[model samples]
Target: MQQKISDQLSTTAERPSGRQASSPRAVPVLTLVSHPQPQRIGERLLLETLANTGRTASLSRSAPEFSRPGLPPGQPLADPFLSRTPVQFAPGTRGRLRLLVPKDGTPVRVAEEPARGAREFLPEELIAGVPLVLAERVVLLLHLTRVPEAPVTQELGMVGQSESLRRVREDISRVADLDVPVLIRGETGTGKELVARAIHQQSPRREGPFISINLSAIPRELAASELFGVQRGAYTNAIQDRLGLFRAAQGGTLFLDEVGEAPPEVQVALLRVLETREVYPVGGNTPVPVDVRLLTATDANLEERIQRELFRAPLLHRLAGFEIRMPPLRERREDIGPLFLHFARQELEAIGEAHRLTVTDPRAEPWLPAALAVRLLRYAWPGNVRQLRNITRQLIIGSRGLPHLRIGDRLEQELTVDPQSAGSPHISGFEDTADPDELSPSRRRPADVGEQELLQALRASAWDLKATSERLSISRASVYLLIDKSSLLRTAGNLSPEEITRCFHECQGNLDKMVQRLEVSRRALQRRVRELGLGGP
Candidate 1:
């Protein structure tokens, strides 16, 4: 029985990497066992396909050494319990099979030659086990076990179980300990800053301050003083010595957001500081040393910016010691439901109404209906996670007393409406109500208002929600809901690039003032400016 089993399982194996083949006709064969089934038994099943060719699978409890650069010594790439050895099949061979079995002490073997047929062995026929074959091929030993439980980890304020997010978390873990500059790239509202904070919190600089700034928010003329500090008499308005972001973030991390919007001169200064590990305050000849881990984020294409001479190549190289790209919400739709629930719970708790909403099971009670969830998933989240959170807050607040907000029909109806007629009769029922907060001071609600009129009122009110609400004779919550549902809110208005530029100058490049003058949201204005290639003043 042993000789028959050996002959049946033997293959024309090739020599192992470091050894010579014992027989010229021998082929390499590898054996691997799947993690044990849910039932606990110690029997290893031999996969017929793998036994036909002699090649051993290579499984390790950690990520391969070659894939783990910058990882601390002795640190496993992933959870050891869940890790599996990778198997490499030779050319023309089929991929590996997921074979699993228990320790039933059954003798198993594959036919020596290929045949398109299945052979079954009775339990009593394979009582005696065959000896382990010693071939020139490498044999990787693996003990199959149940799927490992998720390891306890600091989720870093991120809530997602998608593969993309998992990879991001792993990347963060791998590079967190290294004191190197990191560049985060993602579309608008993808939470680049959150990733940066995670890195800082995981690093040695966790105890130090985390200073965050938006480069686009800083005017070109003020970039230098705002970033590297200003002497008491640096400029006409410099009445006091101010420690800028660099010094403020000493011994910690400095996150520069929208860095692609930085002016040419500021880019040069940044490159200098990165190279020297020091900063020269505006109007000061002395160079001040700063120990700050720099992290940068942008939605712009820096490589294109480099081609256009808008950004410095050396600075880009300096900041991008490691690059992490955050996947957009549309790409990770599976996370949307969980994110909505998380935000909804937080909103409910904040309003002291957690008990009013059912939280035990997501599939039932106060949670969004399945149809609404499907609608949400189907919609392209151009605004990403930030937009999702804002929409969730609006939904929760708007659905005050309802036992459950059935959004399927309402959302679908809103989707079919023409965006240009944002103030049409579609949302007619949301007018004056018994709630005092919903009542407008005008008492006479505006009727038949269109998108143009709404835009004009928003502009006249300086983008102030209260003022806009009053002008439209609607409740503040309704105004927000309108903004959320209206595509017109995001579309470019009648203002031309030249007109926006003139208004920007008139407002002295103050973004708030510019938004008010343009009658657009700050995000819309910035996006327009970027689209026009105007480069904000």
Candidate 2:
């Protein structure tokens, strides 16, 4: 556990500013990975270390008890779905854990494989975290983490029990009072802007207005004036003098979202501002001093953009006085259940259906099944929490007046990865030891796959042609061939001008979104957009 868990957290002895320490000390805990009842998710059981041989898990009050903080302490699993016969977990020396699955009880699956009678987990496997599927009723993750931190709050407004997010919180607390510029980075919809707000709300500037603007959404020509104000009569549309976001956020924070997309000239202006604490209006020569705290966020790979000469290196350095990274939702699957419920509760309340989640009878079947929660947990979540919110909203609306959350027929199929097969083998930071059978879906001959499989593959791959080909274990050419043969599939060649034009505006000239909407090759989509003169390079 010492070596492996240390590897799990950090490489070197020095703890990176926004990362965890290299200490081998970690607490082993069992997280309620998923449940039909969403509130129970993320509850954990903390185990003692080898010094105390860890706490032995056993049944209490006729059911296996898992707590609000973790296993072994507080709450009880009074739910009736669990098998009465207890599954005993005994801890041994040097971080070893022995499990005894009752003969009459449903076989406990460890990392998706059934443990016949008894099983022993080595320290390394426990450090990487093992998923235990109990009677198909609930999922639990047995993993090591640093000591518990404070829970999510109204002020911070982030959710998760993962140590990674804990480190993020620590980063926020450490920097909030320093008055230093902070740069946030993460995948889209991973809540980089939310983190920026958290910083602003917690900082000394909390009383002042926290203004935020998306640099990418503003036109290139107008970006400078938007950020640094416009002098009256500067342009035909400049009917009056305007105070830019810098002055508007005086004595507070101005969060520049999508800072990587800042225009070339705007980048130079930003660098000047960072160095001088001043801004020059669009038509004025004199620089106005600013007293606002600067925070910026981006999901782009600015280093790559710098290589292309699209962004200035000096600006990148200035924006990144201190960097905080928001880990994607997939990296912390345990948070998925909590986050989904958090988002779902709002929609459910809005529709006046809040009581659907409340359970009066323990014997009654849960409206939201554990199996469906597993599917949600196993999803890739490329669009992160924002996409999860959309899916939650979809379930709430699409299933209005239903007995349960009626997962759409299409979404049900798309999320149909086998319970025993998907996401059981690996955690994000651990080494990949994926089963060969995991890739078996691709082993089926491309010709044998039906139109249904093609569409499913396209959806799963986010309409990426190369990824789709790899998913089916076929060549790129075979994917194109399948598209040509399928009557339902559409490519850029066959797309109507009106459709492309509509998609271009709706997606705001984002090619990736166009690729997803049109279900066509990205390169081909770009060519068609250009040929039609829709917009963008």
- Expressed as tens digits, the lDDT of each residue in 336-390 for candidate 1 is 6567767777887887767644433312322444334434544546577997898
Give me the runs in candidate 2 sitting further than 4 Å from their true place: 1-24, 33-37, 49-64, 70-72, 89-100, 107-115, 118-131, 148-155, 416-537
lDDT of 2 by residue, 404-522 (tens): 77798877754543221112223211112323532355455556878889989988987777788788876454565566556567556546689889999999999988877788767
User: Lowest lDDT 10-mer window, candidate 1?
Assistant: 33-42
Give me candidate 2's TM-score against the actual structure. 0.71
TM-scores, each model vs. reference: 0.52, 0.71
How much is the lDDT of residue 327 in candidate 1? 84
Residue clash pairs of candidate 2: 44-70, 44-71, 45-70, 45-71, 48-54
Candidate 1 TM-score, C-alpha based: 0.52
What is each predicted model's overall lDDT from 0 to 1?
Answer: 0.56, 0.70
Q: Which candidate leads the pack in lDDT? A: 2
